[model samples]
Target: MSDRSGIFAGEDPFAIAQGWLSEAEKIEINDPNAIALASVDADGLPNVRMVLLKEIEAQSAPSGGAFVFYTNYGSAKGVEIEQAGKAAFVMHWKSLRRQIRVRGLTSREEGPQADAYYTSRSLKSRLGAWASDQSQPLASRTALMAEVAKVTATHGPNPKRPPFWGGIRITPLEIEFWADGAFRLHDRFRWRRPDPNSAWEILRLNP
Candidate 1:
């Protein structure tokens, strides 16, 4: 048996993830929720960028355990996600020396939840989403500003969520948690399950 005790002792991986995130929130300097989101292009080249994870959803069987984030549907990441139907991300907390990695299938989350999130954003950000043709080349910053101004006037206050902008939910098949340890050895645990409703099998890996 492995000496997986203390913070790693948990039947629910999601609970452990939540606890780690809570600790990270207290110690991180900024953007505690920022994750390195990874997606593969049509050519199989990997692309990664920092994106804020909006939510860790926990629901009943066949409909649970997803990481949520929003972006323009036409963006490079979005196109990759739609084409591949899968993605992965890593969240690292330097202060805590801990990291969480996830790989999963992707689906669009463009219902009331998307609408509510859109409404919660700052007016400028909401307007910016409407103004930006993300992943497309722009001639100049001035042109972008002009587009923003035009959209601001056209959409006005109480603007609706754009059809091209919404949320993507990732339902993970695997998640790994890692923490720093002394003597150049680290603590690592992986939780894997075939589907959300299936029982998770935990494995302790050498570090």
Candidate 2:
């Protein structure tokens, strides 16, 4: 473990990640939970976008230490994730001068959990999810809003979660934490495990 101490001290990487996020929340101007989600397309080209980290699932039975986020299943990111079944993301906090990176396998979260989250959204947002064909070319904003209105009238107040819209859970195989240090040097720690239930091997890397 290389005698990791101070902010990097922790047996559980998930807990450490949550702690970093909590601290970032206090100082970040916006979207402290934002992550740059990365995936590969059919052509093997990389794609990335800023997405909110909805939940950090820590130490669970089926999978341990996963991050959760919601999106349209047919969206660009969703298509890439579904095709690859794996992804990586980085959460950087400028104010805290820290960044956390993760590489993981992914699976859809389209069960009751997805339903609950969908229902919790505002009525317009819920309808908009159905109306917007994310990542598709739109003729105009006015056309999109018209479609939104149509969906609102059709689905009414209580719209069920769309089959094509839900959450994705990423179970990380590798996680790296970086913190700023003096003289352009930095502190870096990597935690890796073969599978979700496997023991983590921590390493300190030169920065």
Candidate 1 error regions (>4 Å): 59-62
RMSD of 2: 1.2
Model 2 CA lDDT for position 112: 86
Compose the digit string of candidate 1's lDDT tens values, residues 54-88. 98876443457788999999999999999999999
Candidate 2 residue spans exceeding 4 A from truth: none
| Candidate 2, 1-207: lDDT as tens digits | 656999999898888999999999998999999999999999999999999998887775355678899999999999999999999999999999999999999999999888998999998889999999999999999999999999888988999999999999999999999999999699999999998778988999999
Q: Against the hidden true structure, what lDDT does model 2 obtain?
A: 0.93
Superposed Cα deviation of residue 47, candidate 1 (Å):
0.7
Error of 2 at 117 (Å): 1.7
TM-score of 2: 0.96
Candidate number with greatest lDDT: 2
Q: In candidate 2, how many Å is residue 33 off?
A: 0.7
